[model samples]
Target: MNHSVDIVLPWVDEKEPGWRQRRIEYDQGKEIESTNIRFQCWDNLHLWFRSIEKCMPWINRIFLITCGHVPDFLNLDNPKLRFVRHDEYIPKEYLPTFNSNTIEMNIHRIKDLSENFILFSDDVFPLLPIEEEYYFKDDMVGDEAVENIISTGSFTKGLHEQRYAQVNNMFIINKYFKKREVQKKDWNKWYCEDYGDRLDRTRACVYWYDFPGFYDPHMANAMKKSTLARLWELEPDALDAGSRNKFRGASDVTQYLIRYWQICTGDFVPRRTQGKVFFPTIDTYKDVVDAINNKAYQMISFNENCTPDEFEIMKRDINASLEKLFPERSSFEK
Candidate 1:
């Protein structure tokens, strides 16, 4: 709370009347699933804010970045909440975009945003009590880089929106921090060596093999406003190419670009965690419920490919579990 940090979430309502027409135009003969137009919100805003109220009370403010629509149930009068329209921060040309990568590229434009903040997806929620320091230690971002990757199966062979954006993340990191050999000891040594200093070159703190990896973008992600702004200035062409993506394109870069940038520059702490991850399915649903009941993991996420019906079921079950776990209403709610 003393750090003056805020939470930033990028949300969209696929049910918006104008959104469907815009999606058709942006599809450009490509399937919506393949084009990263599949990002949808199932009205999880209510519970998400509840989790924040129960877990992280020290948060300074919450910025809800949207295309145009705001949830009907949202407490717009709450002084702690701010609604940011895409047209407000992003350029006029990038309007009506379906690409989250493009939107993330321009998040730094949010007016009165704090220098240090945490980015959350509408689907990403806190399962247990978390503190502001969990994201920012001494006002610096908390992150880790991973090198040894297990068999994460292949994504769509062609131009998958998320996978392609990850590749761009690696490209941008390499621009600032050239590849270097990081021994097993380097990871541990970094904790004691320099937690506050900036490295002249890339360090072994972040994980990478053929491509650089961060703590994991699917979970709660901490970021710096200045770092992203600096990245735009330093890599204008890269940012330009990504921002121009009106739809999910192969050239889009992941938000991890800033995480890796901080790690390679020696301005981050390596805090890797194995939280409960529930893929979309009836079975994974049970796993998450058990994880929550047993208090096995402090964090949980439902990230997987699913049918429309399955998505609805998953959202319903997940919300039920969340309501059961944290039954109290948050002040942010009406």
Candidate 2:
């Protein structure tokens, strides 16, 4: 399998009037399942592109997934840029969806998407130069197959829904796979040294008869289109039910299911899956800025769950810091 990797980046312009109106209209009479922070813009998407052009230039194409709006700074003419609206690839029956899982799981239907591609969220940034081999090597996705369990006891009420989705994924994973069987085929792949201290989690869970759960790394995910297709083929009702979720619901299985599937099937190459994650708060503002400026992580995510006031301050300060690192316009921008 040739590893021609493309980047599937899903973005949303929540401030766009028409999209916002539709979102508002959709949310009426329903218990709010998500928050504005999940949809808020950082005014840093151009910087995201700049980081990509500067740090990861070998990408074959960047499919910018959007509901309808595209960033004004994007160079639509760039050969590596491909703007994909939700309706372009997602089936019509699943339209008007605000669920990221629905939009992502259906991405294999994109006619031009490469078989081997990486899924990037709008907020995930590549902080330093990265090689294509970092994402794909020897025709296997570079990822860790760490095992774990979801504990509602540890999560707050705000995060209970996320736990539910992970539990749902495990149900399907356990449906198709047995832990002893998967590990018996290859011990090293399941307990590789690349996982560092994290391998202990797998060892802890190994005593179980089946997969307990998988650690959902917050960084970008590498995947195979065929794997996505295979997952849907094996479990259409599950994927379709997830797609029909207009908002992320408790029953939904996220795109992480595909990654979990890959791990169980041993279709991935074990790699160090460590990456720095920051949830911006007033107390940690300086730390986030320092990490971004210093290039502390190869991959990083700024989980946007801070207070609006805090987010505004962090957004302003962080983008300013990023501007200093990527001072010039990348070919990605006009």
Candidate 3:
């Protein structure tokens, strides 16, 4: 089966304009540029779009979650893209509580869509190619990670307890597994203090951290649809509650899920290392591109002394580091 991936771009309309322009100027140490805060917001969105374009070859579906003002170009004729507005999925009472309503909309979308798919945030761009083996692993869930999350009582303490929920950023879920049953089995009761004994008897496959941090940390997290469907079956009205109130921002759900996994599973997943490159802050996109071409990592700090030749050496070093880390995949000829 072809693995479907969901790219979630949750955005708000209130950000400062020309923020991107200013960021470029700040990075380049250029003269005072126009501070049209509204422009910055759009520019950032544009950048996100560019990043998405770069990742499109590997992804299957792109879900744009927004409160208001979706770019018309996106909605006009993209077959692979779907625009989900906040008002369409979220309840009226729970709307105002969230800083960005798109997150709630995303959750609702995930719940409604029966297909199994991988989810991603727009801020995160895939820098390297993804192999099929990374996603379809025999042991997607780590036992040690789950045990760590359980030990922390994530289900019984703090915001998790207050909201009676656990959140995750990227996870695999399908409609076949009866996750509702697992949710109803006391383990879902975030407020309950005695969940330890009950959890030991359950068969929940959850990994606390992203496995093989080498690629994308969000890539391998999976939950069978059967698992989530079971949870919903157990608590028919579980999604009806205003669960967003207990957290600070849109990422709370995923963050909580990570913590839950950690508490339940003691093993911490290591983040992958890619060769680091420097990003220069320049007044114009061309300057930024030039800096990248030259391999200037310190230019982001506005280092005027950096010469073009020095930047070249930096690029060579970065390539060398990549070669060391990924000898087999390294493109540099010996």
What residue runs in model 2 are displaced by over 4 Å at the alpha carbon? 29-35, 154-158
> Which lDDT tens digits does candidate 2 get at residues 48-78?
8898889888888999999978788888999
Worst 10 residues of 1 by lDDT: 193-202
Which scores better on TM-score, 1 or 2? Answer: 2
Backbone clashes, candidate 1? 3
Candidate 1's residue-wise lDDT over 91-198, tens digit each? 887776777878887889889999988888876767778766668888777765553222235666434566667767876776556545333334563443343332
Candidate ranking under TM-score, highest first, comes to 2, 1, 3
Candidate 3, residues 145-208: lDDT per residue as tens digits?
2221222245422334323233222231212223434333424332133334333433333332
Candidate rank order under lDDT: 2, 1, 3
Query: Of the candidates shown, which would achieve the greatest TM-score relative to the real structure?
Result: 2
Q: Estimate each model's TM-score.
A: 0.85, 0.96, 0.44
**Candidate 3 residue-wise lDDT at 140:** 36
The TM-score obtained by model 3 is 0.44
